[model samples]
Target: MTLVNLATVLSKAKEGKYAVGAFNATDLNTARGIVEAAEQEKSPIILQFAESHSKYISLEQAANMYLDLATRACVPICVHLDHGENFNTIIRAIKLGFTSVMVDASLKPFEENIQNTKEIVKIAQSLGISVEAELGVMNAEDGSGSLDYNTMDDTYTSVQEAKEFVQKTKIDALAIAFGTVHGLYKKEPNLNYERIKAIQNCTDMPLVMHGGSGLSNEEYQQSVANGITKINYYSTMSFEVTNGLRNYLNSNSDAFLFDVDAKTIELVKNNIAEKIQIFGSSNKA
Candidate 1:
């Protein structure tokens, strides 16, 4: 399996040479596309399987499918569990051969988040698995375009809290709140670059940026400069792939639509390859 340790990849990023791509995957095509794009770029990549993905969809089957695809490719790859909340699932991911797992206890109180994350680290560490923990909550928004804290606006995280959390939990990577919200941002995100810099200076671990799908180009560049080693992209790539397939079928329906529609794998791969290139990971692998 191509389950290389994330610590190695993070070390590479620490040198400011090549930033590894971390793509969020929901299904087979998306996972394949991520690995294929990494291979094309000759860069290492982290394939993140989010826990919020429709619940209890056996990781063994998924990891095997994606891991096999990754190993045979020409680049280093890692399987990661994103936003893993439950202990059972985190353990399952480790048992299923995921090299890294994110334990998001951001919504919990400080001490509780620490305990929760520490428990995960303790278990995963013994099993040769890496852990990623989140310090702040990213509020969820609705389709009606409103700040829904009750439903889910923003919860900022402190740089000091981040460092302490990491020290107490011993996680390999830390995802902090720097003003960017999760999912597709409806407005221009006012990312706190200052906070990011502070967190980076405080903690030596690689930083992960959630809600990367809709950030402006300048914001992304700034984030990378400020210490965003891994960016979690889900919404944008998913939309791009789905839209590409739809457009291909509709535009070519009269001619090669049927034949081309059958080529789902290539379509998804090309769609994701476009994203990998745009994210500046094309040749960094």
Candidate 2:
């Protein structure tokens, strides 16, 4: 099967009561590992790369690799742009063959965020690409000392606004902050399931949950129960592969960095495969 939109994946996930894993890819090997894991599990997956990650690997390089791999892989795969702020970056992603895109205007005011997101939606629509937009902010709130505290923050989206935005923007999916933060969480995030439910009820679009790394499996399940179909994972997968490779290479300093030995690849692959199973996407292809 070819690359599909976020709607199809999330719709299937909504029926299955599971969240599709959107794994962050930094390099060719990283992308390869993600695709390999999904193939092994027979799970459909979205290969994600944020705007910041573009500095290291341009959209061209990453997209080429993902497109090639997806064509050869045994399962459905979607290349997704995660947390991109501007249209320039987003247009580049669309041009690079990304099947899905996320415009994170949560840091901006409501009206401006909507305008910019709507513009992106227009462009992506012309390209037949799925667009995901965020409504609220998910900041890094570390400790009591941090002023960024938002434990299940009720700055949550109102049902009225959600309906208007989805209708105005024509976005394929909506990502609400809920309680999950971007980086690691200092405390267990108590997601606003009620808000998710209200948002899901507000419109028929797919619901996306960010900050997938820090939440517990039970929390993730609750999110799925509340209509979360797409779960974005970045730090978790990076940590998993890096941690595994670090532990393996520590015993042997002769490890080649350019072309990782088969043993090291196995460790990384195993870690990713485990996450694919954990996210309940196994056998989902």
Candidate 3:
């Protein structure tokens, strides 16, 4: 029964200098896997449902499942909404008991992004819910689609603008774009640790890293050392789960659907546990 808000866990991460893993849950088994990993590692975790994933599962269904899992978990778990584009959808998620919500207005003009995020922060903060907003646009868009690796430099977050955005919006966390994209990278990414340090110095609060998957272990540690306190990881975890299912199917051609589901849960749990260890959140609970 250690369900908590995003800021609560992030504050601890900021103090400990370890980034918490914010893993996206695509289904019930995936959600279960994330929590199980956290509990096993004794780490605090963020269980998030992305807006684009709505096509696979409704918001209400995900919210209900997340809340139930959080309440029954031993380690601290924050139920969050990832990349909530529409105002109504973000509000709806808050009302449905999400501990944290990310208002992604980065695609709009700077001033407009600030204004949009301010509106949500005003409401979410009052109810003791944490609000996270993105500062710069990612090359791969919101988690999936075309990836323009060539234009990645164009989306690097400006340190000055990041300071102003945090001051204006009063958000609990800031998701800054450096070199990471939302989905798989076409080539090895050249991350901007200096920019991460600069933003951390100015904001003096928790900083979030989107497109957290596909990076090397050293990259993750470097990002955390440079002041990334929350890392949004998904694509790689999803990929690993699919591969695990495929391998199981290959070995047992007559495997039942329930057997595959059980294997998915196990595979997902193992993958997330490995990530939790890599992020240096293990034993941080």
Off by over 4 Å in 3: 141-151
Q: Residue by residue across 1-285, what tens digits does model 2's lDDT show?
A: 778777678778878877888888777777787788888899998888888887798888888887888878888888889998978999998988888899989878888888999899888878778899998767665555464444446666667778888888889889886777777666656667898888888787788888788677778878888888888887766666677777778876877765454654565567678767777889999
Task: List, residue by residue over 181-284, the lDDT tens digit for candidate 3.
Answer: 87776677889999899999999979999999899999999999999999999998898789889888999998999998889889999999999999999999
- Report the C-alpha displacement of residue 111, candidate 1, in angstroms: 0.5
Q: Could you tell me every candidate's TM-score relative to the true structure?
A: 0.89, 0.91, 0.96
Better of 1 and 2 by TM-score: 2
Q: Can you give the lDDT of residue 134 in candidate 1?
A: 90
Say what the RMSD of model 1 is: 3.0
Looking at model 1, residue 206 earns an lDDT score of: 88
Model 1 TM: 0.89
Q: Taking the tens digit of each residue's C-alpha lDDT, what string does model 1 give over 1-285?
A: 255877767777766633466787766766776776677666778888887873645667678877777678788788888889888888888887888999887888999999999898898888778888898877654546785323322476787788888888888888877777666767656777887788889987788888777767677778878887887877876777678778777877665644653455576566556556555555555
lDDT of each: 0.75, 0.80, 0.92
Q: Which of 2 and 3 is the better model by TM-score?
A: 3
